[model samples]
Target chain A: MNLDLRIPMGLLFTLVGLILTLYGAGTNGSPIYASSLGINANLYWGLVLLVFGGSMYILGRRGQRRMEREPQKPADTDSGAARRGH
Target chain B: MIHTELTYVDWIIMLLYFVFVLGIGFALKRFMKTSKDFFQAGRALPAWICGLAFISANLGAQEVIGMGASGAKYGLETAHFYGIGAIPAMIFVGIFMMPFYYGSKARSVPEFLRLRFDEKTRALNACSFAVMTVFSSGISMYAMARLIQALHVFDHLFLVMGWPLGWIFTFSIVLSAIIVLLYIFLGGLTSAIYNEVLQFFLIIAGFLPLVLIGLKSVGGWQGMKTAVASIDPRMLHEWKGIMHPATNPMGIDIIGLAMGLGFVLGSGYWCTDFLVIQTAMASHNMDAARKVPLIAALPKMIFPFLVILPGLLAISIATPHTTTTVSMQGGAIIHETNIVPPEVEQGRGLVPAKVNPVTGKPMLDASGKPLLDYDMATPNMLLHFFPTGILGLGLTALLASFMSGMAGNVTAFNTVFTYDLYQSYIHKNASDKHYLAVGRWATVGGILLSICTAYAAINFNNIMDTLQLVFSFVNAPLFATFLLGMFWKRTTGDGAFIGLISGTLAAVLHHGLSLPLEAHPGIHGGWIHVLHTYPSDMAQNFYTAIWAFSANLIITILVSLMGKPKPEAELVGLVHSLTPKPDTGHATWWRRPEALAVLLVVLLVVLNIFFF
Candidate 1:
């Protein structure tokens, strides 16, 4: 169970999410969106990414914490082992 | 058609995106302790990430632009690609097919064939797939280079640096290819998947704004509808002229779409194509694997809203609808036909439109029309809408999409080359480390091969057409072989192998025989005049697939029944009836693949009805 992806994925998403959210918020009332059917897509989508990233980050953090609480058990993964053909 | 300025902020944003993607790739390089990690992401990706990458692999820059071009040429009718062509096949793959693929624990699609039938079948699929992947990947490279050239992205930079314009296309291709080769060489499939997911987000971020700005410029969806309807009423109809295959602008009818595209070509791609399925295989478990393609369905069904609509909107904006009269040799005069005047074509509309002397605007005809280049619709729309900062993001999104597609193909190519061809034949029983080394070298070799293929691919007319030709030539018949072999225990190894070869031959024969004599616009198939003449390349591609598939199914059944059937005991996880889902007990209704498939089908139906 190498579920070690969440942390890095979470960090990347959060970083991009933050930038987009701020950019969206700053451009909220800009006339640039006049051509976009008056929809602040950047704002809504940015917020959405932010929430998604935040949730992933929290879950990853909690999982890491839970794993830390357990005794330092060796990983049970067959990570480098060659796979057998079907 | 449109020109937008790029600012420092946009440049910074673009630069950041590139650095971040490359950074992720390099960082993941340390995790590649095994060949499995390089080839299959250590089989540990989540369903959601896998799902995004699965769809994003196909959603390349070529597809993005091609969809828009289709929209401009064919109108709402283009939705059939997503509606009839993709959704059903996706559901079928997720529900019925993934069980065998995931449960059998096949490392590749060819491995599945080897398990179910034998090595000969696997070899056939592996060889064709390896070749096709390289060719297709190269096409993407060529297309991206061509697009950047068309947009004049490098002209200004080259001018400032005293570089010749002729080197722009080659320079762009080589640079992008090197960057891709580096990351993929480092991280392999994991890097490709990660980059694809990032690209999925980047694509949405880039295009959503374009759509909003575009619709607003045209006064929303209603305005687009009115504008397109005013231009050509047929463009508004999903199935208007489909009843008359020969007469319609888009050759084939609904029946053609359902059987040719949906059943044969679509199933072949979604279920069996290794490039698409590699992401799904990287999932942690059976349940996640099943969810991958199913989840991809939702986005596939709706992408036309962005990809296709932009093309239609761009055409409307171009508005080359000036009515012209033409007299025939027999003295019959055609009236009010929307066509470009010969003089205007000679003066304008090749690269850029001629401008009015007084107004300095693009010159309009007596009927207030300007020359329209339908394929440039999406790019023009991007230029029309986005300002400096966002424009870079949008263009980068397109670039990201192309890169993602290229990465997917390269990864698939190397895996197939090393695992199926090289390891099995040339160096049997090689160490895992040795295979890993071969895969890395293959990545470099594949990129170089793809560059050659891309240059070769330019002899063809359109990227989309070339892709369809490949599908027709290889995958259509392959789907039939998979369909029979997976479910029927009676299917023989000899039957599968022979059937595959014959099916490919049938597709080639069909294409070389049935095409029209004249050089037709929108026709990019390898058809010669012999049997039947389709009105468009779409029809030709579909019919060729249909013919090939029919031949494959018929011959496979005939050959299979001739041999003694394999016993049920030997076909546990390979056969549908023998393979039971022991792990599915804990899965709730929503989590079940079949349930998810039904929900997706229902949504697809609703979308089709709404559009129709």
Candidate 2:
């Protein structure tokens, strides 16, 4: 799977799982509360953070990989080394 | 006359516990080969030990005593302080913050500031945190001493001391402080971690029995439920009664306060405080550091049930009629109006006239009238319930908690002093040996300062209240600067420094000025009631955190824009560094969208069911 798609998918599943756990724990009410809200508040917020976090993680990794694959400027290397020391 | 005395078994248990603790410190001394070893445990602590130490360091006399008191007063809602107030922040620190810190190999939080910003910001933070550590340590010591005296374990030591040991209070404080100091000074962070692991187990063992026995005594879960129901239905509801203006002093909106506390206080403490971070930083690798919080999170979730539930149970078992009145040592009652309910009141003078039909103990009021002081509720429960040997074990467990917390604070102070202050400023070219020596001296100084602060903490009615207030006034300001410095490249050292100082000043001034208005309004005023009335419980903390954070963000942004921007290279490097590498594996469950989504769901559900 493409890294971007894979990361977001993984995050989606995790968010769903989190929502389920929260619902079970009584953060969201049993089925009754969900009906009142006309939407699952637990599942909704849970999925948001999950998907966002996962997408960010994946995007962040892809950017880093792209940077690494590109030719390194000598100046970049020296400055990177110096910065790392500090 | 009836004589109450500690048995041989009690003495033996106490002796063994002391020796075992001391032995752990001494044994780990050989590991103190370098300054790093002493301060950061050679950066080799395992994830589990770090996690255990983190929990133990936090579970001191202040938490045990204050949480118990809160449990007696607030019921299940007190768990929010432990669960929401503590856990999420810890998870954030473990998942996001620690990886950055450990991967970079920064020795202390202030040192991280020095790298990210400048020396002035580092120094400012170090000084503030140092003052805070000393005060916190002192409070821990004082609580330990008070608990010891209350237990009356030293009544038999008169012969050893001579002169009827009139100085037991001073003696107990000094003795406990010295023992804790000796181990920490000898083994540094390594000993602290090792001792904390043991103490963590001991505290659990000590409290578990109380919960079990208390549950049984109250006639199992049904009985407990019925007893509590008979007293107050709010006792079972975790989130009800939390919003009442009378209970909370600062007139804080509970939802806002809970969120602010969870995000700001949690992030600041778990991420920024060296006392907690030192444990994770001591891990063998970044993975270990990251894992520490996850490993620790389980216990963190479970402990409130063990510690706080018993206090609630104590409330259930204590009868309104059984409450005794408090009197001054001079045998004079101070006042009648101070009367409190008997079941909740602890020491003399706060309850209506009453005599304990069982013990024949006179319950006296401040004016020799019978009154109950609910503060004594937990202690009275302990005295009534536990057998002699178990009581000694419980007392030792309490002491273990104090020692563990004291050791963590002392070690952190010493580390910051040795690394940031002493090595950096005092003796820039000092050898490893010299640094190690200074580290020991710093530990000693930290202990002495803590002892003094502990004595002062005694005067404060509630340790947790004082601690929360201190965090609001001090640490909340630092959070803005640290977070912005990490994420926002535009934040200059000048901006960070100015924001921190201004935010702190605002919080302190607000707290101090608000006190008088809260105590007595000059006029029969309606506006005063709306504007000036603060929620009595944690409103100060909520208000301080909000205002302090706002002040910090505003000052930082305003000052930074006016100042020259950081070099593009530096800014780019910082931003780039924050971007997680694919191979680091540090960006796992925590950063996973699914996990956070699930967590939020859980959080919302818990809030809806338990809170709303």
The most accurate candidate by lDDT is 1
How accurate locally is residue B366 in candidate 2, as Cα lDDT from 0 to 100? 47
Off by over 4 Å in 2: A1-86, B1-5, B159-163, B241-252, B320-375, B455-471, B512-518, B521-531, B568-578, B582-612
> How does model 2 score by TM-score?
0.75
Using TM-score as the measure, the top candidate is: 1
Off by over 4 Å in 1: A1-86, B246-249, B318-372, B457-471, B516-529
TM-score versus the correct structure, for each prediction: 0.85, 0.75
In model 1, state the lDDT of residue B64: 92
**Which lDDT values do the candidates have, in the order given?**
0.76, 0.65
Native contacts, share recovered per candidate:
0.07, 0.01
Instruction: For each candidate, report its DockQ versus the true two-chain complex.
Output: 0.16, 0.02
